[model samples]
Target: MRWHKRLLAAGAVAVVALTSAACGGGKVRGAEDSPQPGTSLSAADATFTYVPNLDVVTDWDPASSYSNEIIAMENVYESLTRYNPQTKKAEPRLATSWTSTPDGKSWTFTLRSGVKFHTGKPLDAAAAKAAIERTIEVNQGAAYIWGAVDKIEAKDATTLVFTLKYPTALDLVASAGYASYIYDTTATTDDLNKWFNAGHDAGSGPYTIDSWQKGQETELTLKKFDDYWGGWSGQHYSKIAFRVTPELTTAWQLLQRGEVSFVQRLNSQLFAQASTTPSVQTSQTPSFQNLLALFNTQSGPLKDVRLRQAVQKAIDYDGLIAAIKGSGVAASGLVPGGLLGNTPGMTPKQDLPGAEALLKEAGYGPGGKQLDLTMTYAQGDSDQDLFVTLLTSALDKLNVKLTAKPLQWTTQWDQGKSKDESKRQDIFIMYWYPDYADAYSWFVNVFHSAEPISFNLSYLKDDAIDKEIDSLPELTAIDQPGAEKAYADLQNKIINEQAAVSALFVQNYQRAYAKSVEGYVDNPAYPNVVFVYDLKPGA
Candidate 1:
């Protein structure tokens, strides 16, 4: 996500003043304001606030939805299994431990003794099986994650067994996110599904929903779950407050005023100013995000591969970076650099001559015909505007007329997937941040033709590409070298075919907090994984 620094910097002083009012002069002397040193809180005491960019969360339903709101919801909800940021491994959350058959096609999990749901009902093996089954039976959109399951059996009150039709590496990753959150079976299936679909939320996590005012704020209180399998210790905060501030300037103001202890989504301008604030500290994490442009191949002139390739060649990536004025590397492949199968080197240069020739070959020339194109992006996102502006300027040099249309994030998302080809914009500028550290997570979901919600908005497909992706697991099972070779081959194919064009850029996650806040460290594996329990008042 690109943040415009100038806007943030200009509002920093006002934000700090506002934050002071919000905190009501509750000052943490030195780092002493941090939570009690070394004494961790149990589920009952831990709490904090997270300010998101959206006013209304589109999807909160775990089974069939996808959005950042789910990330915040994860704190209050418990999944069967959770990803351990420290270990980069999946660990038991609702389930105590799990085992897989030697053939890797079947598995079993044992629930912890005496676990209870937030509603005070006992969570037995039967309940666990029902939750997993409902995920498939009701939310078909999430079928890729749970549809492979052939059977789920309850072996008494404490044990659950799962049988899969095929081996899948996604089994663990899928369980760690909203895709596998366990819900109470006693509630109306429609109510439960509605909670997941709309912003209304219910979960078995450490926190419980206290109050949620859509597009404004969500408040949660730590619930003392004595029945929680994870032993509780003396934890930190007792409440969490999440606010939605779509304007970066407002978020910056809130942070400086102490209305919020921390602020994320910092751009270059905010980072620089926040770094100098005596009351604030700034830090960043390496992220698995890729900035790219999506071409609408179904209806636009971009339907011609040559025209698409020509447009790809016309982008001045370096110029775009300069416009943003930040520390981001130019991206060349769909998967950004530092990933398992990233194709090294900068994206091919803007070959103006080559582009012109390709356009001519595609029956478009200086006097041939002027193609009309519209580029759509999320409104209020300054970084996206920077990209669109730079690209439009470049296209102008190529004798192409481009119109820019900025829409609300939710509106743009809805239209981007509309079935009516004519209603969709000609081009889209967006980014993809991986859920886990895997090539398949990035490549398969985004490009695979089989994925119902394929991010491949381009609608590009190839049989060979499909076959190679399908055979990845088998190749990986045979040997590591073979798997590497297969992925490299895939990247090469994508580049050779001009499958999608993107400028590689440095992946970084930035956060700023008051000097009194402590225990915040960026996780390399999941950049967003900041355990609420880890926070304490600083000296």
Candidate 2:
């Protein structure tokens, strides 16, 4: 993570990451796994493997790792609470139970006893307290997730209390979030950068990073932690490796060749092929993610509302979907369907003449004005080039010149969130996956002016919009009604105003796994979808 964070900023893509500079010197600490007490499962029952849709591991430290895929890190480090997919609630994992004050300002948790880290250090209140403090001190991108933490007190080995400055429902969300995972404080060092980044980790999960070959794969071998006090899930795989295969076709080929156990995502064009492939099965779950082209609303030619409208109207929404053979619904508002702020009926339709008129109105009509713009979309996204080609064709008809560039997902991601306005994208494409379970995760972080300048791709600040977004806390206190109204209103404003981005479709997230893999479960938090621990042999 960066050294300083100004609350959760918008990530270019759906990935969560902590970025840092410096490769320190130290063999990763906590490499020693003590014999766990209650684990009777053999290492073979815990073995698993798959190919990742993306290849990028930024940091292993939970406090600083911000890559979109943290399967290597998160799998090893267990949080105090974990997001329950079925209930969409934060369920206890490390802590046996917890309670918060009536006003929601203070929370106390009862830690489970007999739990120990890989280093044989007991999981206790002090370790939890220290980890939280270290995160704030380190100030990785994730530190802001716990921004409400005013103070944390360790009352005893098994009791920890957190006093917050703002009343929050974090327990139901943030408690199971990033940076809240307990670490083995006993293994901490002055040079933590060297410790966590050197392919080392500390956690009480069922797996450990046995080996990692950059640009190749991250192999994690596991054994049941008998001392684990939380519920265990997954096929008892002895090893799981995430090999780097950024292309969907390559992933599909890997499965066909018996080189991988599962492919986490299948491109729309290949969805049909997956159906008939021998020894393969596919799961189609609706994604809470949306593909969008964000504008640097803070400055640039896009500042004019008419130009924004013209840009929106020029693109063929349905054509883009057809070109890519995408499998999801066309998006309505900025927030995708299935969330609070989504407004379903607002899906955009192509209006080339409407766009031409708007461009002319904005003083950009053939010979009247020729607007030149640069657009970027991540490389390796299926049919990205086709979408760009169609968009370019429409723009050419409008006499607007567009320079389309394809960039690696990471490069485009960094450019999208660049702090320098000059360096940010005039328009860039990335998927927005819900950071947490609320609209606040999307609307506030992406558009709010108060957040770090890097994340507000639009660089917008409106008093009227701010007032409505500001009322979220109070509205959330009202529970469903308030949340529903506030989110719906926010999404409506964003859509009608042609706010910061050119919102597109929300696709159905689909993944193909070997027929032998049965326990694979879909998770909204992991945007590409599927958890490593849930897969076990099917009956």
Q: What is the C-alpha lDDT of each candidate?
A: 0.59, 0.66
lDDT of 1 by residue, 385-440 (tens): 77778778777776788898886554565576777777777777666665545566
Q: How many clashes (backbone N, Cα, C below 3 Å) per candidate? A: 39, 25
**Per-model TM-score on C-alpha atoms:** 0.81, 0.85
Lowest summed lDDT window (length 10), candidate 2? 3-12
The best candidate by lDDT is 2
Best by TM-score: 2
Question: How high a TM-score does candidate 1 get?
Answer: 0.81
Candidate 2 residue runs with Cα over 4 Å from true position: 2-46, 175-177, 217-226, 230-235, 409-425, 450-452, 477-479
Q: Candidate 2 lDDT, tens digit per residue, 1-539?
A: 44122111122223434333222222222224321223222334444556665544656777765554355555677777776667767787788799988777788989888887866688889998888788788877556667778899999999999898777665654543456667876566557666776566578776655654344343233344544554464445555656556667877876765556777667776778988887788888777767777776766788787888788888888998776664666888777655566666778899998988888888896767789888878655655566688889989988898887887555665676676767766776766665555556666666667555555566778778788877775456446676777777777676567556777777676778777676777766655534556667543
- Deviation in angstroms for 325 in model 1? 3.7
Assess candidate 2 and give its lDDT.
0.66
**Candidate RMSDs in order:** 7.8, 5.8
